[model samples]
Target: MVNESSVLFEKQGHIGILTLNRPPANAYHLEMLNCFNTSLRQAINDPEINAIIVDSSSEKFFCAGADIKVFEANTTEENAKMISQARENMALIENCEKVVIAVINGHCLGGGLEIALACDIRFAAKHQYLIGLPEINLGLIPGNGGSQRLTRLIGVSNAIQMLSTGDSISAQEAYRMGLINQLFDSEELMPAAVALASKLGQGPALAIAATKKAVYGGALLPMAEALELEKRLVDTLYDTQDGQEGFRAFVEKRPAQFTGK
Candidate 1:
C-alpha cells in the first residue's frame, strides 16, 4: 500500500530524497503535481541540501505517466494548466542549484521519462524495467520538454524514432543510447544514488553550479559566444574562496574542504 500523500520527502545528510507515493503507478494528477512541486521547492530552498534524488515507493513503476483520467475529466484548457505545471517543474529540475538524480527501479514511460530526462543524472536498475516516450500512442507528443531535451541528450534521429514509434527500450538499451548514466541491481539502486550525491556534496558548490550553467547555457549558443561564457565562468570561480582552497589543497597534497562559498 502507498501513502495517501502523492509526494513524500526525506532529508539524509546533504541529500534530499523525494519519493513518489501515488498508488497503482505514481501517475501525475493535479494533486500529485502540486505536491511534487512543493516538495521539490522545499528541497531546493534548503541550504543544507547539496543534492537531490527522485525515487518511487512502488517496486514496479517509477511512474507510468500522467493520469489519463485527469485529462478525460477536464476541458482542453484545464488540461493545459496541468501540462504547464509539469513544464515548470521540469525546468525547475533542469536548472536547480543542486544536482538532481533520478533513480529508476521500475517502468519509466511518457512523462516519467521526461522527468528523468530533466534530471542532471539518471541511474536505473538493470532489471526488467523499460523506458520510453509513448505519447504518440495517446495521440499526443511529449509536452514536458521531452522532445527537445531528448533530442539534445541523445540525437535527433534516435529521438525521432522513439517519439514516432511509441516504443519502449530496456534499461541496458537505454544506457547504450545515453538515456541513463549508470545501471545497478534493484537492491543497490538507492545506495548507489546516495553514494553519488555524497560525492557531489563534498565538492565546491559554486564551481559545480557554474559548470552546469555553462554547459547547459552554452549548448544553445554559438561556439564563439559559448567560449566567452566559459571563460567568464572560469574567471569568476578563480576569485572564490573554494577555488583558492582547491589550488592550495593541491599544492599541499591534501583534500579541499569546500564551504560552498
Candidate 2:
C-alpha cells in the first residue's frame, strides 16, 4: 500500500533519508509535493540532521516525474498553484543549510530530474536509470528550476537537447557530463549513496554549509561580489565553535566533533 504520507523519513545518525514512497513510478502528485516539502523542511530545521539523501521506494522508477494526469485536470490558476508548490519543494532542497543528495536508482524524468537538479549532489544507478527534463513532450517547459539549473549544470546546449528532445540519458552519460556526481552498479546504488551521505555527515557541518553557500551563491553572483561573500563567510566561520574544534582536533590527531555551531 502506498502510504498517504507519500514520503518516508528515516534518520541514521546525522543523515536523514527521505524516500519517495508512492509505489510503481513514484510520480509527483500534489500530495507527494506536499509531503516532500514538509519532510525536507523538517529535516533542514532539525539540528541533528547533518545531511539528507532523497531516494525512491520503487525499484524501477526513481520518479516518473510530474503526474501529467493531474496537470491535464487542472485549470490555468490551478496549474500555476501546482507549479508554485513544486518550486517551493525545490527550494526546500536548494536553500537548505544542510547537504541535499539525490539517489537515482531508476528512471528520473521531468519533475524528477528537476528535483535532482535542485540537490547539491546526485548519484545514479548504472543500469536502466535515466535522467532528463521531458516536459516538452507535454507541450510544456520545466517549471521547478529545471530550465535554469540544468543549463547551469550541464550547459545551455545540452540542456536544450535533453529538454527539447525529451530524451533521457544514461547514468554514465550523466556522470560524464557532470550532471550526476557519481554512478554505481545497480545493486550498489543505495548503499553507496548512504555511505557517501554518512561520510559527509562526519565533516564540520558549518563549514559544509558555508562551502555550499559559497558555491551556489557564487554561481548566481558577479565574481567580485561572490568573492566578497566568501571572504565574509570565512571570517564569520573562523569564530565558530566547530572551527575551533576542527583546528584543535587536527593538532591532537583526533576526529573532530562538530556541534554545527
Residue 36 alpha-carbon offset, candidate 1, angstroms: 0.8
TM-scores, in order shown? 0.97, 0.95
Q: Which 10 consecutive positions of candidate 2 have the poorest summed lDDT?
A: 1-10
- Stretches > 4 Å off in candidate 2: 1-4
TM-score of 1: 0.97
| lDDT per residue as tens, model 2, 1-261 | 223388988888888888998877888777788888877877788888888999998888888887878878888798788788899988878888788989998899888888889999998888866778878887888888899999998898988898889888988899888899988887898888888888888878889989988998988899999999899889988889999999999999999888878
The per-model lDDT (C-alpha) reads 0.91, 0.86
Error of 2 at 15 (Å): 1.2
User: Residues 73-128, candidate 1, lDDT per residue (tens digit)?
Assistant: 98999888899999989999999888999999999999988999999999999998
| Model 1 whole-model lDDT (C-alpha atoms) | 0.91
Residue 147 of model 2 has an lDDT of 94
Q: Which residue runs does candidate 1 get wrong by more than 4 Å? A: 1-4
